[model samples]
Target: MHALDYFNARLEATISPMDYVKAKQMSPEKYFLIDVRNGPTHVRSVTIKDANVIPEQELQSRLNEIPQDKEIIVYCWDVWCNTAAKVAKFLLEHGYKVKELTGGIAAWKEMNFPVTNSDQGNNIPDNCGC
Candidate 1:
């Protein structure tokens, strides 16, 4: 099967980029958007708001840190990145709810979804709704 087919199959046979976006809007706090990109690389791209910054290399030891009850949506910098896929598979193997963000952050940006920088001039206020 093609990689895309494999990804869709892993998504319980019905996953799409738009589905993830819709799920994000349903309950922002319900799902965990786990970013597996390295620190330096992630900083240079469009990062999602409140995404968990856990590098792929450290995920094996850090899996316990994530709440198993919540669904995990793994993502990386771009379509070429496989960190998200690997993380998703690991989470699945561990019996945790998991899904890989198709095309990762690049696709998120392409869809014109919200992106923020933690280091940027406080565009978002501490108490203000984002």
Candidate 2:
């Protein structure tokens, strides 16, 4: 495929921070936001509020927890992080509709979007003690 075609195709698998907000506003239930940061990073950094906490390393084991009906939107710490992309790709390969959050949580924070600090790691699901 041409470079432009490749770029366009790649864009389809990603969502911008602003567009994410709009999508959530339009239909909150249509998307399933997952924070793929590891336990340590997630505890120290702020994450998009209400995002399901599933560290990248734990994804395979937690795959069943992800809802198949909603479009998965995965995000990591920042633009430098590739955890989200890896997780998105895994989900796609496993037959799930997924998208990586462009620039990750850093871009979302740069956009001044709503976020919740996870000082105590409470964002993680009850079943996960980490």
lDDT string for model 2 (20-125, tens) is: 8899999989999998876454444677998887777678888999999999999987777777888888899999999999988778888888998765444544
Which 10 residues in a row give candidate 2 its minimum summed lDDT?
121-130
lDDT tens readout by residue for model 1, 29-59:
7787776775454253457777776667667
Query: Which residue pairs come into collision in candidate 2?
Result: none
Best by TM-score: 2
Clashes of each: 0, 0
Please report how far candidate 1 places residue 119 from its true position, in Å: 5.4
lDDT minimum window of 10 residues, candidate 1: 121-130
Question: Model 1, which residues run further than 4 Å from truth?
Answer: 1-15, 39-45, 119-130
TM-score of each: 0.73, 0.85
**lDDT comparing candidate 2 with the true structure:** 0.81
For each candidate in turn, give its C-alpha RMSD to the true structure in angstroms: 7.9, 4.4
Local lDDT at 129 for model 2: 22
Give the Å shift of residue 127 in candidate 2.
21
Native-to-model Cα distance after best TM-score fit, residue 69 in candidate 1, in Å = 0.6
lDDT of each: 0.69, 0.81
